[model samples]
Target: MAGLAVGAVVVLALLVLLRRRYVVARVWGHSMSPTFHDGERVVATRRRHYRVGDVIVFRPRSRTTDVAWRIKRIAAVAGDPVPAWLETDHPVVPAGRVVVVGDNTGHSEDSRQLGYIDLAAVAGAVPHRAAPEGS
Candidate 1:
């Protein structure tokens, strides 16, 4: 009985902490190459808003899957004019949206391929990285 009560408390604490803090995700592609490599685990803080140059994870708009998470760099912010490539009258990054793209243009599928992601879709921003082996 004591163990069960302690377990329940621990679970509740985790739920509350996760709701207010960050999450961890393992990078799976080369989209953020050089900065974040495949197989790397990244720590994402959910409290802060994304800014230019910050690496963020967000779900893309897609038909086949309910969620499509990707890690990319924040290229623009709300109220900014749309880039020449994006054909939309709305600001590229509206008040609740973020414009993200991969550093490796050659192989990344990002905002350049899909479109801006809602701020709610942003899981968090990458904060720390583990050192590479032998480094």
Candidate 2:
């Protein structure tokens, strides 16, 4: 009986933490494939400071469609150096925004296509998978 009570408390605490720190999202394309497959579920923490190469979930400001969210890796963060390889004439990442891209470049619509992502829209880094759990 004591073990059951302890298990319930642990589960409840985890749920509360998750509820406060993360928001659930679902991936739906090959844009981030190989890393995140189509129809894969994702959880991103609440908006916080992020660095380059971090995967984030955000809403694109340049998009006019009803699409809700997008998940991609941050290529550049506010005021960070933009590599010469990016092929952009404007080299530095703008303030309060980030340049994002997908693992699957060929199929992704990222900073390469649209403009930088607003920091205000960023949800936060996607949590790392602890194990090879199935989708």
lDDT score for residue 112 of model 2 = 77
Cα lDDT for residue 12, candidate 2: 100
Stretches of candidate 2 exceeding 4 Å from the true structure: 1-20, 64-66, 85-89, 129-135
* Worst ten in a row by lDDT for model 2: 126-135
Candidate 2 has an lDDT of 0.78
Q: Candidate 1: which stretches are off by over 4 Å?
A: 1-4, 63-68, 128-135
Q: 10-60 in candidate 1: lDDT tens per residue?
A: 999999888667767777778777778898877788845667777887766
Clashes of 2: 0
Residue 38, candidate 2: alpha-carbon lDDT: 89
Candidate 2 lDDT over 1-135, as tens digits, reads: 999999999999999988778878788688887788988988898865887767888888766655588988887887888755466767688789888888777898888777778888887679753211231
